[model samples]
Target: MQTKKYTRLMLASTLVLAAHAGWASDEGTLTMGTSVNYSSGKYGTQTSTDITSIPLNVAYDKGPWTFKVSVPYIRITGPSDVVVGVGKTSATTSTVRTASGLGDVVTAATYNFYNNAEAQFGADVTGKIKFGTADSAKGLGTGENDYSVILDVYKKVNQLTFFGGIGYTALGSSAAIPLRNVFSLTAGSVFKMDEKNNAGFAYDYRQKSSATSAAQSELTAFYVHKFDKSWKTQTYLLKGFSDGSPDWGAGVSVGYAF
Candidate 1:
């Protein structure tokens, strides 16, 4: 009886935590989600759990182009970047504040470069833009314009799929950003979890380009569940390495199909 109860609890917990990210299904539909993030390292050590936001998104997959837009509302508590000198010793600290209102936005235009029955590759020109917010108590943002060129490739074998991408972002304007020329690589597998439902796990790694001495990296694990034939929900956990950004975060999202 104890073993059965433990199994039931674990299964229940997974069901409730499963979610989706990055992509939503819709020709022109919109969706939203919220997440809590933490940051640690040279600059500061902090945690922001009440950051509520939405992924205002629109997607279209047409003959040759797949267009996507993902913009979010964000609020985070972080340490202020400052150096304090006491006598002959100086210490640096990060200030904490509440950043609110409109947040970072991303738009992308992707074109298929190669596609066969089991394999495909594509390229995307993506833009990352930041909008000003009223909550300046916490460095709401550094108004900036950034662009990335992504090369994506994917393959399907039996019931498993492999996908990965490498992208480079050119950062400029506003505040000093750590990520420039970022490269991402991801791979995952899918299984028929239920007779009518599908489930899978994927792992992803990202490295960003930087002018600073230290750079940042991200490692993430994800699980996706499909409801019905056209909808999917997923959950993900991310860990950032190096510094210059958040330490850890988690999120969930829902998607619809047309």
Candidate 2:
């Protein structure tokens, strides 16, 4: 395959897995987070569109299990005919306040077959519900429920931490369950700025169940900042590869831990 061939292939694969990617810990605990996601691309002859959203997440964790629900109240937009604030498209976004109600719900449990606060090995099962509005025309939801199972591993070397997960989705017949099974590999490291601040970079590779499956990659940078004994904020920016959307986005939220 040519170079561009690989890029385009990767893009298609990423978009397929894009609708839901929980990037981190699944073990049940309690934490809250929020972020803004935006992306633009082409669907056909017409220039695709730009979407912006505010996603809110509430999660609970107990030992080696975790469950989370993300809600995104979003505005659909078409290509802009003008430019406004932040050099953003001038196109007027639709007034349709669609909801991803529990749309991106995820539940995971880890057994920690072996973990030393620096390294961990376990298996996880994830279930996603499609209760959100799926106006394929708007590219918001997949319109079906999806199931996945993965074996995960994590390691920490000083300030450098690495995490990798490999799994396969049932790929059952569902509007949301992708036509083909899926696979993922992820690695990330954290840098401590102090007792209250940490920053890091992450890289991810995802593919389908078949040999024809293209590998999609992502690059992300984020910060975890603590303001007080109980208040903190975690923020990150994720960019997809090739033709995949969500190519450019950022999010930040304040949270409290008890």
Candidate 3:
């Protein structure tokens, strides 16, 4: 969701500059950011698990395209069956232990292919790859690459912007841990409070990626503030409605543009 929101902001900025010189920009933008996220849940288990991650992200926006990368440091305290982001796995052990190490690395590219300023509508296509950089022995991630693609669209009316997206993911699998491909959906709206501040809420749903896991449904509320053209920050809180999601989660991020 964080990455998707960034793409939306890029589109909005592109629209603002469109009248000056077409839809694509003459000068590219580079952005960097970091976020800290924490989540805790039982995930259909008898004991609760806690997960924390701090990720570094960077992006380059040129013309109507955006390229991004993210790498994270993760800490987990849970049973062996619980996987970060993926929830319960097929492991039969219930032993709880703490582990900390590098997490998976994700890369993505987004292309804005359609825009109508007068009608206040825009759309983008994005493809992502998640590399298995995390240590599978420690259960940080599946030691195989995963791929996904998404289509996002938005419309603006007055002080509000409505957005939605649909995506499909091809999960990586191994003989010991077979996985399932799944579809995901997201929808949300942002209310502009002023030139520098805005708040929004989003709902996300995803099909189960493993037979042992339940489908995921989560809702998040977020606020973003811009201090200047080159600096901004965001904070969010989320609640889960299914065992595949965290019972509750919160995160904060700060970004700089160059």
Candidate 4:
């Protein structure tokens, strides 16, 4: 019943947003990317999950408003329990299961609420929705929708940019477990080394999703390079600090803009 209600709301919201997209003046950009991630000891358990995903994303930016959407095809190899917010059930003889299908779809809209050119400061308000498109039977996702609102602020000084954000997520409940709404925080800074290269690091903290789960904390370092005005690539390494997070992971993505 809750899922159905959320589905209806999502559809209505999509229609309204699509209407706005249709009236937008600028041409939107489309990006395609693929990445692979491997993790061990997730959710404080001795289990591993490996995923290779291809994401298709589209974004439109005009004036101070930006709208974006992403849909990803994911292939997962691991125990089903590991993917569904449940820890490993056994230390031995736990057969590895593989699932491949569409992952969740996400939509976001952001408005620049404040900006100061001289001070090189700006703030944005963003709203996001994550639709449960992955199959629950395959244990690829929670099979419920999620909504989030975030406030982001950034300041630029010379070749360095600093950013931070705070957000709250309303996680949808599933039959197996009821998830709690959680708050999240992130802070990061990027340094532009030259016209083609940049590096940055970020720290993220997220509240626990389940009653018995630990909160999540992770640190990430990323490098980005631009081949030209239309092509770019980025790579990142992450280290998790809590049982609810992956031990370590890495991924790279290539993007194109027009």
The best candidate in terms of lDDT: 3
TM-score of every model versus the real structure: 0.65, 0.65, 0.91, 0.82
Can you tell me which runs of candidate 3 are displaced by over 4 Å? 1-24, 91-93
Please give the lDDT score at residue 249 for candidate 4: 63
Tens digit per residue, CA lDDT, model 4, 170-213: 98886665678888787777777988887887777778777566
lDDT of 3 by residue, 32-119 (tens): 9888878888888888888888888887878878788888888989888787757788646578979889888888888878877888
Return the TM-score for candidate 1, rounded to 2 decimals: 0.65
| Candidate 2 runs further than 4 Å off | 1-29, 43-48, 78-103, 107-111, 117-138, 171-178, 208-215
Better of 2 and 4 by TM-score: 4
| lDDT tens readout by residue for model 2, 67-141 | 555555555454332110111112234332232222233333333334453232223443443242333333343
Per-model C-alpha lDDT, please? 0.40, 0.43, 0.75, 0.63
lDDT of 1 by residue, 154-221 (tens): 55455444455555655443333333445545444444455445455444444433433234344545
Top of the candidates by TM-score = 3
Segments of candidate 4 deviating more than 4 angstroms:
1-38, 84-95
Of the two candidates 1 and 4, the one with more favorable lDDT, higher being better, is 4
The local distance difference test score of model 1 is: 0.40
Range of the 10 consecutive residues with the lowest summed lDDT in candidate 3: 13-22
